[model samples]
Target: MAEQGAAERGPDGLSRRRLLAASAAGGAVWLLRGTVGPESARAIGTAPVLPGGLVPYQQVYENWAGEIRTSPLWVCAPDSPQQVADLADWAAANGWRLRAQGQRHGWAPFTVAAGTPADTRVLLVDTTRSLTALSLASGFGGAGGRAVRAQTGASLEDLLAFLADQGLGVAACPAPGDLTVGGALAVGGHGTAVPAAGETPRPGQGFGSLSNQVLSLTAVVHDASAGRYVLRTFDRSEADAAAFLVHLGRAFLTEVVLRAAPDTRLRCLSRVDVPATELFAAPGSPAAGGGRTFADFLASTGRVEAIWFAFTDHPWLKTWQPAPDKPLFAHEVSAPYNYPFSDNLPQPVAELAGQLVSGSEQLAPVFGQLQFLITKIGLTGDVTDLLLAPGLLRSLLSGDTLTHLLAGGLRSDLWGASRHLLQYVRPTTLRVTANGYAIHCRRSDVQWVVSRFASSYQQVLATHQARGEYPMNGAAEIRVTGLDDPVACGVPGAQPPLLSALRPHADHPEWDTAVWLDLLTLPGTPGLHAFYREIEQELLGLFDGTRAGLRVEWSKGWAYTTDAAWADPAVLGRTVPATLRAPGAPGWDEAVATLDGYDPARVFGNPFLDALLR
Candidate 1:
């Protein structure tokens, strides 16, 4: 069970018959045959189904976190809706809880409990492989009159690639490429964009969250009599729809329908060694003068992104444009893909320069080992690499250290000797230096988040300076998008009557475009979070609740909590319907009454009717 992915779990834990039956009840259930010896089943209140030989528990569970493992009492991989329905029924009769697991990337224990039958008991519906159906559905009653219907198990990368093949593409997306559709939608994954004018915005809205683009969804609900009911909903229902979009199927998500845009090619440009202070400063301000200001740059380009290196005075900027005008081309640029200090490293660094410019996985191990060394001595690096190959030094530091170094360096350069008295100063300075500059290229619509994160051109220079980190002295691009959907989170006040009403003027196509702010930070530094928070707060203010807010990449460093304990119960109570609420099932009259204001019966429910009713 330890150190395994989903593909490696042992089969000895449960019986196939019991697993199927329990899974029929809508929860992850293990057959007695899979978990215990044939004789031990009696003690657990279930008889063992010994027909197929036992498989070891080690072979069944596969998790990515490496810190925890789970052994479901029953694991069911249902291929179709009917199979899912049947499994729900069986779990209800057997008194087992149901858990729908996808990708298993979550660090929390929401999917499986530890150290009890609860961990191995009940049925777990694995979505990793069961659902692979992907196709274009025409005349789907929505805008554009066409949509892409994806089964719950499809990967986002595959989905985008598939769509692109069909001459279509995702309007926005998160940075990492490996995320799955189900996982993204369930957890409210987001992308970055500036809302168009007249778009109602709110606090904390991030464009990367997938909930904004969902056109429709299908969920399997458990009812009072332990029967499974399928529920469907469209974009119009506000309260229930919003709740469903954010909810990760305490029931089950069977399908997702997304509204996609036509495929288009984008050109990309990059710049390195730019001063961070001048990049993100406010428009027309003195601090942002003598270089392309972030706002002005974004206004001129198709898209813009910026990356700043900590402990150094350079920021990388990238800009992209649609294809045909500029043609597609790949670069040999180096940057972090994940945190610089993550356990997953691409390779070990043999030189100081290699540490600065390599991507995240490649940089983390080097940074950690060197950081340990630096703790004993002082921060050390090759002087030649510091001046001529700063990227190599960046490849070696943890993201926290990098951020600190950059902030410290910026503070030192801007404020001179006065910065030495700060509270967070390091005992020793990083031995790296650089003269930042910009590179020009066309914009790309695909992989906007990645392009922005990696590119050094579009970073917010002023924010870095305010925090004592040197700002990139390059353009920090930003664009705006008009708010269309009322169901989308971050729109202030009640949901809009229709999305089109908020569209920008017809004369300007770019007027209503979503804003993308490119940013960069030093690797292995703790200041990244604070800097991000400040930027988020500022963006939320400038937008003035007229559109969706900023998008923070959760997998990278944004630590979001799924714990309901921290959630505002009143908000939940107001947003979720009484019938859909946990524990007590609503009476038929109550359900009907609840359905009166909103569209009725499209929402799904769980099969434990009596338990829900109680």
Candidate 2:
């Protein structure tokens, strides 16, 4: 149910079931049925009196994969912070719960749980429609000090663009550009980054998730004296600020002020030639001697990511380095989303994806290979691939003209501002569901983390393939970033986000870096839940906090059973809380208590948050 990526050949990047249903006789009407506009907003029976001067409408909810959909329900768009507060008060008074709705790019039920009926007493506060405001804050220390004050509805892309205009930017951000700033902070969204050898962070810069940059945040909280919810601002120095920093949608944030540093130019290089065996080889092994191992790139440049297609030998590896000026022979980019081949599907890939949607499960191998081939040709613009394959493979790859047509230009190497290179994922890419985790370990053991994950994933895939169950038809994505460090915010008594996955373990001070791993596949693929459950078990045992610790990424899927995600009672009740906070530690319990103290009536919580947070 994640909200990311899209396609044109089918509905939102060819969702398998949707595509099949779309191609069926008289199915187009079925697909178009129930789509309503704001003008058609309706209230169910016995609707309570809404706040004056505010309009309520019926809106359907759908996540990125269209997995968690709902019938038309109540929604509202508040134009200002005070209006949002008014809505919160109205919800509390009228027996309704308020859930902030951003772009709906997330997979988890942080916004609204599945199977929620049309008559439920839940009110969705649509932030993106209004309340988006961005400006620079002044008078921190002197003129050199910089910070951006943005409303919750402001998008990451717009915020980055604003900073870029002033030669100020954040150190890292997630790949997709459409995410709301409030949503990103709520789930502790992060990007791949860490300091290189002998590298020191500049003022106002931190190599952690976006939530770590908060200088202050304004939220709606219950006020005991007022006997209702009221708008309150919490500084990073306050003890209660820790809980609000990454509240996982249990709280509502209206605005945030984030520290920004001077923007740096960057050069990005793409290589689809490295074999997975060498790239993910054992640490210090001879196979990893070619200076192309993942660790080697991380050591030299400190910014890297790998996308390994299923059943493929070579992985598409990308490395980013600080480049003060555009490197000679590097393509200069003017904006974000430069990789057209990735943003849009090529002809062969679209055809294969259509076949997959048509229930041709045996084509998983062909689909994986085809994806890799398209990447190779699209990245380097090398048409020499036509003769490299035989039989059906050659026929499929023979359309070099179509590949180049889909890929606007060769993008093997590029140079630009950090945002252009850092944010490459666009909304037009294929939409898929992903299971995510952050593995905490010492920087020296990053190689071991990658090696173990790669080996275990191969074994799992082989087992499923042998049993004729092609559960995965997508790639394995890997990235690394530094853990959250409160000192980087340059504020005295500032506290780190207590619930953040990157929050440094109190007992394990040596764990400085977090390796982010995600398995991506189209939703509703057969046996995906069981496969994810096995992978989760393997990961929990492999890391086990002895050498490394494992935690779930709040935005993606986790806590899997045989049938679904976020459904395992043991994980939801005990393991997840224990992973975040030890029995005697000052984390999970403190966060839950602080949130409850702010919203004692649980007016801001959903069913999922109610069960998990407790």
Pick out the ten consecutive residues of candidate 2 with the lowest summed lDDT. 24-33
The pairs that clash in candidate 2 are 2-64, 2-106, 3-105, 7-13
For all predictions, the C-alpha RMSD in Å is 15.1, 4.2
lDDT of 1 by residue, 267-338 (tens): 344454345556655434576566565554554543455544333343445444333332323322112121
Off by over 4 Å in 2: 1-48, 142-145, 397-407, 583-585
List TM-scores for all candidates, in order. Answer: 0.52, 0.93
Flag regions of model 1 displaced more than 4 Å: 1-74, 105-122, 193-209, 223-227, 231-239, 249-251, 328-346, 349-614
Query: What would the per-residue lDDT of candidate 2 be over residues 1-614, giving only the tens digit for each residue?
Result: 22223532333354554443332222232122233434543445444457867777777787766677776677878888988888888888878999998878889999997657888999888899887899988755432348999999999999999999999987789999989999999999999999887777778878999999898999999999999888999988999999999999999999999999999988999998889999999887898889888888899888989999888899999988888987889999989999877776655565565566455767788878877877877778775664566566667766564556445787889999999988998766776789999999999999999999999999999999999888888999999999989887777888889999999898899999999999998766778899999999999999999999999999999999989999999988988898888655569999999999999989999988999999
Clashes of each: 158, 4
